[model samples]
Target chain A: MKARVTVSLKPGVLDPQGRAILHALEGLGFSGVTDVRVGKLIELELAEGTPLETVEEMGRRLLANTVIENFRVEPA
Target chain B: MKSGVVVFPGSNCDRDLMVALELVTGTRPVALWHAEAEVPAGLDLIALPGGFSHGDYLRSGAIAARAPVMRAVADHAGRGGLVLGICNGFQVLTEAGLLPGALMRNAGLDFICRDVALEVVTTDSAFTRGYRPGETITVPVAHHDGNFQADAETLDRLEQQGQVAFRYAGEVNGSARRIAGILNDRRNVLGLMPHPERCVEEAHGNLDGRRLFAGLVSVLA
Candidate 1:
């Protein structure tokens, strides 16, 4: 089994990398970009029958820092 | 006071910290590896030095924070033993749950490395007791992920409880409330972005950083 975890900064937390990308896009003549945020995608290989709860636990423990980031786990 | 400095594989400041600890405390510090499950007994201080630990993979300090040695460090911190994490060490402390909040990328997206001015916000912690509260001094900060952030209520509580030990004298990194160093709620663990070891000697330019180490040894001894 494979699970993917997407970690993102909590709303209202500053994302300088995302903001820089927005500015760079504007510099490239793009328009109407309301906002930009950057995040991480983690791929995990789990044993068969592993529950989403287990992957979510991994996210809570080491994959995402709950203080400033939120994570969602998707199964494959 | 007997001190031990943890050496993660990628840590480059362990020797600097060991030297500073020896100079200030007049006792050689034990160098503990990241894989060690327990810190040496009778250790008064456990030092986490700076560098891109575990190559800053996944997230800054995320990998090294889960190292086997951290379990023992956590136990020590739980027992009221002093733990000091500097720069990258600060990131590890937050990731390891020894401290609150997170150090995000610098607001300017630049790897800032220099001697930045800092104000001693509170002298209540074991680490900052050598300095007078509100005094201004300069220390070296070399990090891209030193921009500290936390929820508003936590920030307020840190302020109200005197956990904020140091604040940038000027806007160096866009930290919340311009915090440069903070003490854990237990007041035994301290995480800060400055390198007090780099300037403990006169050759490093100023003695401003020496007092921090000296003060800790004095108070803990």
Candidate 2:
């Protein structure tokens, strides 16, 4: 089984890297790019039949810092 | 005074902390490897030094926070033992849930390395007892992800409870409330982004950082 975790900074949390990317895009004459946010996508290989809850636990414990980031797990 | 310095594989400031502890406490600190499941008994202080632990992969200090030895460190902290995390150490503490808030990338998106002025926010904790309240001290801060952030309620509680130990005098990092150092609720654990160990001696061109270690030793000894 394959699992994917997408981690992103919480709303209202400042994402400096994302902001820098936005500025760079603007400098390159890209318009209508109103905002930017950076995030992480982590893919995991797990044993068959592994529960989604277990993968969520992994996200809670390590993949995402609940203080500043939120994570979504997609198991495939 | 007895002390131990936790040595994660990428921890570059372990020796610096050991030297500072030895100079201030008059005792060599034990180097506790991250793999060790337990800290030696009878240790008074455990210091976590700064570096890109685990190559800052995934996140800074994220991997090191789950090191086998952290369980023992938490137990020690639970017993009211003193724990000090500096810079990346601060990141580790937050990741370990020993402290509140998380350090994020600097708002400028640049690695800042310079001596910055900090105000002693509170002297109520064992870590900041040596400094006068509101005194401005100069300390070196070298980090990319030193900007601290938390929800408004947590920030308010930290202020109301006097858990805020130090704050930057000016805009140093885009830290919430300009926090430079903060103490845990029990006041035994402190996590700060500044490198006090780097400027504890006259040779370092600043003695302001010496008071933190000396004050801690005085209180514990």
Task: Please give the C-alpha DockQ score of model 1.
Answer: 0.94
Q: Which portions of model 1 show Cα errors greater than 4 Å?
A: none
Q: What is the TM-score of chain B in candidate 1?
A: 0.98
Q: After superposition, how far is residue A3 of candidate 1 from its true place, in Å?
A: 1.4
Top lDDT model: 2
The fraction of correct interface contacts reproduced by each prediction comes to 1.00, 0.94
Q: Write the per-residue lDDT of candidate 1 for residues A1-76, one digit (tens) a residue.
A: 8999999999999899999999999999999997999999999988899999999999999999999999999996
Clashes of each: 0, 0
**Model 1 per-residue lDDT at A11:** 95
Specify the poorest-scoring 10-residue window by lDDT in model 1 chain B: B212-221
Candidate 1's residue-wise lDDT over B1-221, tens digit each?
99999999899999999999999999999999999897789889999999999899888999999999999999999899999999999999999999999999999989999999999999887788899989999999999999999999999999999999999999988999999999988899999999999999889989999999989878877
Residue ranges of candidate 2 with Cα displaced over 4 Å: none
Pairs of colliding residues, candidate 2:
none
